[model samples]
Target: MAAGLVELAGVGLEVERPVRTRILHPIWLTIPEGARVSLVGPSGAGKTTLASIVGALQPASEGEYLFRGERVDLLDAKARAGFRADNVGFVFQNAHLIDERSALQNVALGIIDPTVEADEVTGRCLAALQQVGLAEVADRKAALLSGGERQRVAIARALVKGPRLVIADEPTGALDQTNGKAVLELLFSLDATLLLVTHDLAAAELADQVVTIVDGTLA
Candidate 1:
């Protein structure tokens, strides 16, 4: 596959104690670099679960999963956290911003450097915020911004780390149609190897490929 950015083989997920639902099928798929993918299904399906697995937010239950040639299931918690910070960016339905922090500070959090000067961090943060069309709100607290504006700030924060993979879980759920569309457009524009979980079929269309899950099995 020549280092396809994401690849999955015989991927399956199940819960032991509850035995309530199957979360995944023995599905196999590969997504190359700069490609966009959507995992779409009704509620209770494994869309979000699959996204979590791909982004290394959670480990897989069975089979092989890889990102950038590294076996995700093999990574320890500490290593997984580092891998996610350095290579994966995630946007969720909520921005998950620190209400007390300014947009600039939130963006700066993505760049963790003890030796870097405050001005340097501020400058980089400003640039990233500008890239997401939020320069004007750089000094504003996330609590004060509108939903759309806050989502943009989240995007800026995700990009500040320059991650190769962007994983968004229902990122547009809080928006009106117009705002949702705008938020999604901004997300796709980043051109990272995208793996998204969304219920919006139109949003799924943004991806180069789509995988549908039904009753916890890829359909």
Candidate 2:
């Protein structure tokens, strides 16, 4: 098999305390570089938990997580943050834009690499917005944009960094069918590896592989 861009070996999540609860059961999954994968499940089925682990937003409670053969689960919180900044792009159900910032500025905020020059950042942000067909709305504040336009700007922000992996959690949950489909189309068209968590079956079908989660385990 080709080397996995992301590998989760016996990985799981649990909250240990007065009353311990397992959010995810042991999962062994491998997504090769540039692969498109969707995780589908009902609410509270642990799909989001699994995606969070993969995205470096949450630490695994057991086993290991590797990105490009490097162990990410071993990194400290600060290191994990930097690691995610360098490699992962995220699109959530909400646009999560800074309402005060313009579409162009919002996308530019995604350029987290301090080493990149200011001019290059602006150039890349503009290109990304253009790629998502939001060039015309680049000057509009995020709060002034419509739902679909805001979501496109969110996508532009996610892709502006040119990340190796993109993790989208219910990216279309808040939009109408037409807008949702358009958003998914844009997400799948990206060059990066995609691991999407969604409740929509039709959206799941757009992926190269669909993995279903039931309760706390993959089914």
Candidate 3:
């Protein structure tokens, strides 16, 4: 394959404690910039574990992780945190919004760069909300928004910082069919590379590539 924005070479994970469990078998994968890739697998098959590694939420037990051809697995914890803050945005099945906060406030919290001026942050956050079709509700409290609206706000939060990669773990798993499809559409419309972990085959079909994991290894 051609060089990609992110590359994993012989990456694997294991825990010495809890009786030496191997969660992910050595795997090689490449995610190109601006591409949408869906990861699907059975429950307990290590899909989230692998995605967590890719997102820098945790490190692999062994092997190489490269971002833009640079080794990331070797970065120290603080550096890894910085790397994640700059390059990655994540959305979980739960919107995880603060109900007491307005949509804009929640999205503003996603901006990790302290150097961003307050005005610029507001502009960026509003722009992101506009992108997700939630601009009208920018001032509405999250508690008052519908489920679909909350998810849209979550997406705006992810996009506010202009991340290079978006890792969405079952982003639509909590929505009904209509809302889920809308979320999927919004995700697919992003300019950034997307790694969507989903159980729905129909949702997976929206990606340029769909990968499956079975028994800790890519299938």
In model 1, which runs have C-alpha deviations exceeding 4 angstroms? Answer: 1-3, 19-21, 112-117
Tens digit of per-residue lDDT, candidate 3, span 165-214: 99999999899999999999999999899999999999999999999999
Q: What is the C-alpha lDDT of each candidate?
A: 0.85, 0.92, 0.94
Compute the lDDT for candidate 2: 0.92
* Per-residue lDDT of model 2, residues 1-219, tens digit only: 656999999998889786899889899999999989999988999998899899999999999999999999999999999998989999999999999989999999888878899889888999999999989888899999988889889888989988999999999999998899899999999989999999999889999999999998999
What is the C-alpha lDDT profile of model 1 across 1-219, one tens digit per residue? 445988889888877766655678777888899988888999988888888888888888789988778788788998888888888888899998999999998888877547778888888889889889989989898899999998889888888878898888999999999899999998888857888889999899988889898887778
lDDT of 3 at 202: 92
lDDT value, residue 83 of candidate 3: 92
List the pairs of residues colliding in candidate 1: none
Q: Which stretches of candidate 3 lie over 4 Å from their true place?
A: none
Number of backbone collisions per candidate: 0, 0, 0
Q: Give the winner by TM-score: 2 or 3.
A: 3
- Give the better candidate number (1 or 3) by lDDT: 3
